[model samples]
Target: MALHPALTPVADLVGTWRGPGRGEYPTITSFTYTEEVTFTDVGKPFLTYLQRTWSPAGDPMHTETGFFRVAGGEAVEFVLAQPTGQTELAEGSLVTEPRGFATELHSRVVNAASAKIVDATIRRLRLDGDELTTEFAMAAVGLPMTHHLGSVLTRTA
Candidate 1:
């Protein structure tokens, strides 16, 4: 299918990426996981996003499904839902670079009554050639905003 014209700034992300990731936070011990993130275009104005992670022992760790949309000009929007009982609406700017593009998205979260408290989150995604680097920061569980996870994934599809 043809790429959406508005997605020109982020066309490079339409593929599957897999790599190892390190996760850390103030409330928990640091850990490492292997992650796979995929972006797909289905003849629409937005790209479908899916991410999953697994432990070294092959245990399922985390997963999120979302949609990525370019909201005119350099603005971008991301809406995602997690099984952990939180949904987020994140918005940010998309900047074009020599290699690809980078985005810094800040999210407003809605948590289910049974979910843990999550104050805020910032997600950063950078594309350089065939490599995509992802970082996540959050303010949650009575702690201030802090670095939570990071990974460098390579395009595989």
Candidate 2:
């Protein structure tokens, strides 16, 4: 199927990417991992998103599934669910750059009773050619919003 008009702004993201990433939080020890992210378009207005991370020894660390939507013009939305029992609804703007695009999304998080206290999160993604860089900040576990994860990934497909 041909790409939807609304997805043109983000068409470059419809592939798999992998690289190393770093994670740090006030409540946990800092660490590094291998991360893989994939974006898929099923001929729909939104792109299906999936991400996974693993330790150097190949132990799975984190995973999330989501949908990325370009809601007409520069408006964008992301809906995500994590195995950690957290759901996120994020909204932000997508700005087209000379090389690619940059997006900053702020999310309201809902956590299950058994989950840790995660109140909000902010994610910024930038795409330039085959390089994708992302940074994430979170307000959780009695800590203020601070940088939590950053990664630079190369297109693998």
Candidate 1 lDDT tens digits, 91-123: 999999999999999999999999999999999
lDDT of 2 at 113: 92
Error of 2 at 116 (Å): 0.3
Give the number of the best model, judged by lDDT.
Answer: 1
Local distance difference test scores for all models: 0.96, 0.95
Candidate 1, run of 10 with poorest lDDT: 1-10
User: Tens digit of lDDT per residue, candidate 2, span 82-155?
Assistant: 99999999999999987789999999999999999999999999999999999999999989999999999999
Q: Poorest 10 consecutive residues of model 2 by lDDT?
A: 69-78
Question: Which residue runs of candidate 2 sit more than 4 Å off their true CA positions?
Answer: none
Model 1 off-target regions past 4 Å? Answer: none
Q: After TM-score superposition, what is the CA distance of residue 27 in candidate 2 from its true location, in Å?
A: 1.4
